[model samples]
Target: MALTPGVLHVTQPVDGGVGAYVAMAAADQARRGWRVAVACPGTGPLAAELDRLGVHRLDWTARRAPGLSDAVQAARLRRIVGEFGPDVVHLHSSKAGLAGRAALRGRVPTLFQPHGWSWLAARGVAAAAALAWERLAARWADRVICVGAGEAALARRHGVPGDLVVVRNGVDLRRFRPAGPRERAEARARHGIAEDTPLAVCVGRVTRQKGQDLLLAAWERVAARDGRARLAVVGDGPLLRALRSRAVPGVHFAGAVADVRSWYAAADVVVLPSRWEGLPLTALEAMATGRPVVACAVSGLTELVTGGVGALVPPGDGAGLAEALLVRLGQPALAAAEGVAAAALADGFGVDGALDGLAGHTLGVVAGVGTGAGEACSSSRLRKTPDERGFDEHCQTPWGQ
Candidate 1:
């Protein structure tokens, strides 16, 4: 009998976007009759999701950041790869991209998705080292898949070379349909938000990268104009306590909730002030719930939040962020119109296309085709990053153009 095709996804930080991405991919691959396995710390919501999906799990004692223990972890991952016999190894985020590549060393067809480049998150010596490693590690990947065009462009800008392909992040649409008034009222009541108040919900970790502080600063201006407008910062992180303490009137920290859809249902508008992203799921999820978004005009948001579907302000620009939020929150009619457009845009980003694209890419790599860098989806559109903002590009645009 022919050996079954298998793929192994490896990552650290088993609670955030990276973890969620891996879980979704592994489950989809498994459901399609591929032998899929995931190797991570395996001790959080993602682990539980993987268990539910029936994807083989390997315990990897990997740290969020690089440490001396990387060698040991790499060895463990190598053993798992050997045991699982994956034809393709898909590494998610920096931690897995590093250790998985180190373990495999081009012995297998490996695909690396940075999620967001690590150099963007570090500084000084650490940043320099990350850039250097990324440049060197390009040789290890059969293909480098980016979740957003900005991620691919940023990699090139930093001299991190690879066969880059963009596969925009997607969400499950069935679970996130537009909320009716009854659903909205229940969600708002659960969160202590008044049904009639203009509410902006931000769903993400309370971290510097997520720009919660920027949102808080912007919220001051928003509240100054509309006293009834409320801001809910959902998700937990290291900065949670500090952010909660500094929050003034009209700001509520919901911490982490199991079902974030309820929060989306409660919102008049959704916002993300991220400094960078590989197409944040918060914006996608909110759009799926038929809500307009006000997000920093960086990375992935540039592509997804175009036209009147939502508004995008410059990164780190609190005043601009505030203005965008005010436009969405202060004008209910405008927000409602944008919400309709948002739902239309989100209709193009259901999980099926993304899952199919990833599967195609993996199969092509395993078949010895270089990079598997073709268009992931015919419907996927491309948008320029801030530096090249006015440029019109299509999804068919070749890399390095």
Candidate 2:
């Protein structure tokens, strides 16, 4: 008799992209008849979604940043692991990656997903320490699942040695489809915006990583050029109040909303001036809604946003960012054409495919452990699903293979 496969997903962030990813993965695995449990904060979107799905949730008390309480958190995680007895453990984001890996120490088949590298969010001495920790922690992770090729490239470039696999972020195409004219008009009306308004929507947590501040700075140039242009900064975070205080005219701070689809539909263009990303879900959602994107030429954004779909200016270039937005907002015909192209490109990246690929990798890792082969599974053996076949250069074989 074989035991049922079990997976435990641990994450610190209970909202935003990381939280959403965990919820989706847990729900998918549970529906497949696998024993799946998510250990995360009891509040936020992740918790709410898990509750709605009737998936098991274990309350995990952890902070968003490294602190003295990490050891305590790790101990709690160890207890959870011992009690649940999962076949595999998946840690999402930096804080969970840190504590979970530290607790398990390769004792279990652990998958660490950085979401976005921690070092990218740090500065000066903190950045160096974060990078060093990642390199040392690589030994504990059976596989470092990067959400994008650029994220995997960053790991290799920074010498974070381990089995690196890329499973690009995906969107639910059913929920996010191209908005027709009537839908657009209705969305605009619901948002209390005029149908003819040249709106550029930015949807993400209001943080330095998301670069909402940079987008606001660029919006000055945009507003100066076209006073009729409107910019809506959706979502909320620690910097929300500060950003709102400094917001210029025509810039609306929506804080946070239950649904972002209406915002995408209402916009002529979507903007993401993120400082770093491991393939942001907001960008994918926007593209799936048939909205052109104007984003920073950063790792994940560069991989998705092409000239035909939208514009990618050099990161931190305010003038360039402003110019990109101007081009789209000024020409409705061009933006519409690019949006069509964006939706076409986004068609290739569906949530089902991404989840299926991840499922394949998880099963492969478990099989390797069962065979006492550790992480030394062959590429052919791992590529069981059709989605896994499209991983391209993003997935690599184990070292010494």
All candidates: CA RMSD (Å): 2.9, 4.6
lDDT of 1 by residue, 1-401 (tens): 21457888888878777778888899888888888888888688888988887888988878876899989888989998898888889999888888988888899999999988888888999999999999999999988888876777677777777677767788899988988678889988987877678899899988888999999988898888889888988999889999898888989888888889999999999999998888787888999999998889887788788898878888999999988888878788898899989998888788788777788778878887754224532225433445333212323444323
Query: What's the TM-score of each model vs. the native?
Result: 0.93, 0.92
Stretches of candidate 1 above 4 Å error?
1-3, 371-401
The C-alpha lDDT values of all candidates are 0.82, 0.86
- Give each model's clash number: 0, 0
Q: What is the TM-score (0 to 1) of candidate 1? A: 0.93
Q: List pairs with backbone clashes in candidate 1.
A: none
Q: Write one digit per residue (lDDT tens) for candidate 2, span 183-283.
A: 99999999899988999999999999999999999999999989999999999899999999999999999878888999999999999999999889999
